[model samples]
Target chain A: MPDATQSMEAIEQPAVIKRGSRFSGYLRAISAMVWKDLTAELRSRELLSAMLVFALLVILIFNFALELDIRTRETVTSGVLWVTFAFAGTLGLNRSMAVERDRGCLDGLLLVPVDRSALYFGKVLGNLIFMLIVEAIILPVYSLLYDVNLFHPGLMAVILLGSVGYVAVGTLLSTMAVQARTRDVLLPILLFPVVLPLLVAALKASNGFLQGFNMEEIWPWVYLLIAYDVIFIAVAFMVFDFVVEE
Target chain B: MTHSSDRRLTPCGVKMIETQRLVKTFGLKPVLRGIDFSVEYGEFVALVGPNGAGKTTFLRILATLSRPSMGEVRVAGHLLPAQATAVRRCLGVVTHQPLLYGDMTVDENLRFYGRMYGVRNLQQRIEDVLEMVGLMALRRDRVRQFSRGMQQRLSIGRAILHDPGILLFDEPYTGLDQEAAAMLDTLLRDVADRGRTVVMTSHDLTRVTDLADRVDILHKGEIAASVRRGEVDLAELPALYFSVTHA
Candidate 1:
């Protein structure tokens, strides 16, 4: 009974240091994951390079397939952007996670002290950064070719919302996909369906803005994108502890 | 939530790992049953058994990498399930998976885990770990460029960056060449020398005898047998295991 009591006490207060300062500790953990990912990307540059090139190729193909004459460009630009993002986001997400899982880095991360949710955030941030970087370049290139300015603040906001939602689901799905025998081919198939709502909102909202639709017209899509981002990120955080457990 | 020891305890000092009748299974299958185990502050213990034994499950449970069906598990004196995060903080685990982002560089991989573990002086810590794993020069190289052994070495670096009080190796030696494995052995010993505990799961009995302070044979989902080096009969393990497994 005494040992049992001790054991119970042990569980309740495992860390002698009450996480010191709660918010600081959580932020530190989250930032650390993000910083590591960013630095790693800075060094290799391969992940970003591949994502950019693939995104460009996707835009190129869409250009020919959709036959974007001047009149059609306005209607198609937003759709084209989401299509490129959805495709390119998968490239970044899959390679980002598969590399970790294949090289034993995931096991290494699991061994450490920070919360597992910190990891989920770190990867999501890392993937988002990469996706945004690719989009930054794609938007400029497309604007030069099609004469449509995608630099509008509202459109940028939409991109943020869509990217967050895209990555939330992507990160979770990638975790599972990488563990399967068919990792390389499985990521996109799993990701696309999961990110469909994000795709819908992004496509419609982006188009609404690009096509000169009013705030009232764009608000619903924007709201959906925001809600999607928040919901999945929360779900991902809750489920991450289970998925990453050995 | 129940005891003083379990409440806000210092992981800086303790026996490192302790479990009481740790029980676990996959679905209906019992992988570990009523297994009581513990390791001293700086001891190295080997978990040995044939394929499908509970070796991995035991490590997973101890590492808080997996949940047990029943029983108690503690690491660095942190009670499990309740203090799994605390246990994770003090314990470092390296499994067969590399777990690094291939899209990132070797430098980035080490740096990321260092931060995730919330180590202080992260840059210096990353440098120290990179040196420990002998990957400082290659840190800028993308993970895709690394060979299996190089990646495995980096995996070790990632696990130890936070200076865990307890370390776990689950088939960590798989795919590691002799040189890499030897380096890992030396690293493991050095880690233990720092008053940290090390628990490793492996199939190589001879190596376990060579390195471990004690050895436990896991058969089926239970601890088939456990003993110190001399007490483990070299010639009889196969037959002993067969009987334990059969029983």
Candidate 2:
């Protein structure tokens, strides 16, 4: 019984190294990883191009279906914006992690001497950047098309907070989905359900800001978004090492 | 370039890789029953085996890619499944996959690895590795545009870019033609001559016979036989291998 217990303990022991003495080095590795993904996308433009076109198409469909008159636009604007970001963000996350798995780049990254959390943060940051770029372009277009000013600072803050929460969970889930046999259909099924609460909070906060709600009225949703981002980012960092290990 | 002589040394002064009863299983199936293997520093050892002989599994364990079900595996004094990051610092691996980003150029690929290793003077080091693998002329070419041979050469550059103390190669010559194969042989010989601990898994018996100082037969998940290169004649290896395994 003692021998069996010892074996179980050994098997369950974590493989993560403590983040000490090389925090600066890990930071540099994280930046290098972010740069790697950006350059790869710059050359191919495959991931971004697909995501942008898909996002524009989804918005176009929404415009037609809702007969987006001024009253309809005002009421549905926040829902439209969050929906576009959520759907498109999933597309980008799926492709980014899939590229790493398909090209064997993930294994290459693992073989490096750097900490695995560095890799996780690098990926999260990269995916977040991609989501932001798409959101940035879409915001102006949505404003021009609907004749509604979408550049409110509060709205932008809500977008950033919501994107952080969405991407943190999406990156973790996408890495898992990419390894599955049915990755194409698997990501949304796995992601949308997990991010349901984040979507609710982001939508509520974004709408509150767009409608000129005071801080006292919107404080609860803001707190929820912040709490979601912090909790998931921490959880993702802790569990990401096992997800990528072979 | 000065070799592992300047690298950290264990108290005993001998750099070695040792495994005690390493075992790996996939669900109900046992791949590595029990593996007891060791290689000294500066020795170029080759692992040869049939298709399902578990050579890849064993090498993967040493590379810290796969964990052992139960055993003590140590590389250069760091125990694995626990001290993986420490072990990774001193190891280099070349797998069947090129592991290069296809859209990125050769320079971009090596630059990424150099940053990960936190290599000093990264630009100069990148230039040196490119020249070492004879990819200087094609440094700006996308990896997807290169042929199988060129990609393999660039991969060799990637593996050695970090100047690791221990190197692992898994069937590196799988897709190379005669000329490309010869180029790789020269590079491997140069690396081994520089006194790095080298372990390679290969099915090409004739080539490994010439390059490896020692060859071990991995059959049924364990080392079946280990012999020095000097003792075996190049022509009689096949018959000898069959005879020993059957016996």
Candidate 3:
């Protein structure tokens, strides 16, 4: 213990305590948070596996129940894909925040000196990555099972845009819900209604791309998706500090 | 006994922590009523109280984990809620929960926190902190595999990783065995010896008497009594605590 005190002095008056500029520090904190989440998930495999399995199950169930012919599958592919993504995304968002809450790591994150929004953005980025990964895997599988081409460029763009909007709002809502005992059920109840506008836009744009509709036909929904993504991201950034505050 | 109005400052005339008329409520129920509290630089003040006395609430507010419903709170000379980021940079907090990631190894946990704090020369600092907490041998082990004592020790390492000037600990000894608690005592002394102001909340009277330079009793959301070391005999602390809290 005496030696501990001696070493403590070394930390107390380091010859040089090099901290990055504020902007760099903020970026570093965000990246660090993302890295922590990714690393933890890599080890546990709990969050991604659950989301992927759930996503696959949803696709399989839709395949059997809808039993769509090729013509009908083309029309319904967008709807089915969006539903699968939304449900899987909700699972990922809920589990991610729950891990933080259960382990008291959320408080640990809040204690950092960076703007609380940095934490919010970091979680958002992490959740977006997980959702994209799940979607990437689900895309080819859904195509195989339903025998429909699901990889149009415009459809990809819609997927990315939709994911951004969904995750941005889901991340914020999950932060709020994680504080509640009924968080598992609370997130979807809060998220689906709030995210409905963006989801509708995504579904429309995706359908237009699949149906080979002209740019003029798809432009409005694309614009709506873009608008919703930006607005939700900005809103989440502004209110995240208040949402996480106890 | 020091009253809330006394406002005792360190020899250098600085209050490391000060709160005036701090009030906190949860929904409709009040947790912390109008209360004033302060700690000087390098002082170790143990806040003892019965359950629901608002000791955790008070420490959480100082740690900036909870917003005081109403108060003028300052830490390390910076007003809180306004300069909270500045205050956070100067504070290291250890609550009852370890606040560590289970899947991450001890080394990775420190590295992650090091990055979050933007601590320079992080590798060397992590090594030093691991050594200080006596967890150097288990650096690569997953935190979930650790015993309760080991996790608490790592929690201390995480708290001190950034070398903050003030530490707020809430029931750090909870769930620790006799040996682990003694080890924590040594660490606490070493920390205080390094000139960091500390405010700790504990239910253990004997341990508080041994480690705290001053003891403040909180009862029903307010300071019921306060006494510096040597002002009261160590043997009578339990009696003092009971009389204050039960009164």
Candidate 4:
């Protein structure tokens, strides 16, 4: 082994110098967390594959069950899409947190010296990305199946807002649930009730956008969605430390 | 090793870790009950106890992984649950679990933790850690494919990656083979020789005697007995352990 003083110096110098600015370190920690999740997901393809396959199955089941004409299809698109997203997003969130808990990686993350909220936001961003990727794939499939233009910018905005709100609350609750024995069933049970208001607003705004209603009509639900997203994100940011703590 | 009569402070007058009247309860049943413990800087104290004696619970509280229900706890001069972030920056912990992403390569796992700790010149640091753990050749391999011993070594590498002032190991040798345990002995000795304060909880009395400068027996959430290495006969440790725990 190297000399004791030399080893100590080698270990302490970097930690001391790296503590220069708190904000940059916090941001770096978050980005590192996000990058770790994405890299692992990319290699395993477990989380996304499960989420995407489940989402496609939900959409396929809905398409066969409701063989609606073009007019009717346009009206129900938002509802169908949101339901598929909600269930699939739940699967993604549960699996993401379960991976951490299973390998004791959650404690590893909690041990990081940065603000714990950084871990929360990092997980939210990662879940949001996964949810969006699934949605991105599902939208075109739904467009082809129903022959509806699901690519409207207004619709996209609603989807982003809804996803942010959903994932913000979902990530926090999933962390709480991951600690339990029945985490798989517990997350959706805990998440759905809490996310109902956000879902309602997203569904309404998405419907308005799909139906080509006036911006004035769509703006109310859009505003509600945005408000829900901001409120939940702030609430999650504040309570995440408590939620993850034992 | 000689016992330090001054239990409150190190030569530098700083207590590395200290807890007073520490209590932890799960719902109604208590795990830790009114425990008081302290370790001076650069001390290697092995906390030994039988199963359900709350050794893990006490170590977790000191590591800031769990909160004390009612007590004053401090590590490296910072209070816990309040100065937890500060405590974390200077603490290195290894539990039974590897706490690594199996899908990622060994290099990736260290890189991830190194970035999380904001270690400077991370590439060089990763190389040094891998070299020290004798896993330099396997750095590119996925961790899931590693043997338990390899994983444990990597876990130690991860814990010491940031070079914290204090280290906590809770049953780190739980699943390792004889060879692995021997390797860990070398690593632990090297870490202790570097003058880092270490508080490890273990069921292995033999290994405890070999690695720790002082041995503390925790029974029913309280410190039952403490002795320096020279104070206790090596062969009689098991008897002392059983008597204290059973009594």
- How do the residues B116-235 of candidate 1 rate in per-residue lDDT, one tens digit apiece? 554567787778888887888987888878877787788778777766656788887888788877777666666555544678999776566666767788876667787764575555
Per-residue accuracy of model 2 over A119-219 as CA lDDT, tens digit each: 98999899999999999999988887788888888889999999999999999998888878998899999999989999999898888888888888888
Instruction: Sort the candidates on DockQ, descending order.
Output: 4, 3, 1, 2
Better of 1 and 4 by lDDT: 4
Candidate 1 lands at a TM-score of 0.82
State the displacement of the C-alpha of residue A111, model 1, in Å, after optimal TM-score superposition: 2.1
Q: Candidate 3 on B133-223: residue-level lDDT in tens?
A: 9999999999999988889999999999988878999999999999999899888877777767889999998888888888999999999
Instruction: State which candidate, 1 or 4, has the greater DockQ.
Output: 4
Clashing pairs in 3: none
- Full ranking by lDDT: 3, 4, 2, 1
Local lDDT at A8 for model 2: 24
lDDT of 4 by residue, A110-189 (tens): 89888999999999999999999999999999888878998899889999999999999999999999999888799999
Alpha carbon lDDT at B95, candidate 3? 91
Cα misplacement distance, residue B7 of candidate 3 (Å): 26
Error of 2 at A11 (Å): 28
Give the TM-score of each candidate. Answer: 0.82, 0.92, 0.95, 0.95
Recovered fraction of real interface contacts per model = 0.50, 0.44, 0.55, 0.57
Better of 2 and 3 by TM-score: 3
Superposed model 3: Cα runs more than 4 Å off: A1-17, B1-11
Best by lDDT: 3
How close to the true structure is residue A18 of candidate 4, measured as C-alpha lDDT? 81
Please, what is the whole-model Cα lDDT of each candidate in the order they appear?
Answer: 0.75, 0.83, 0.88, 0.88
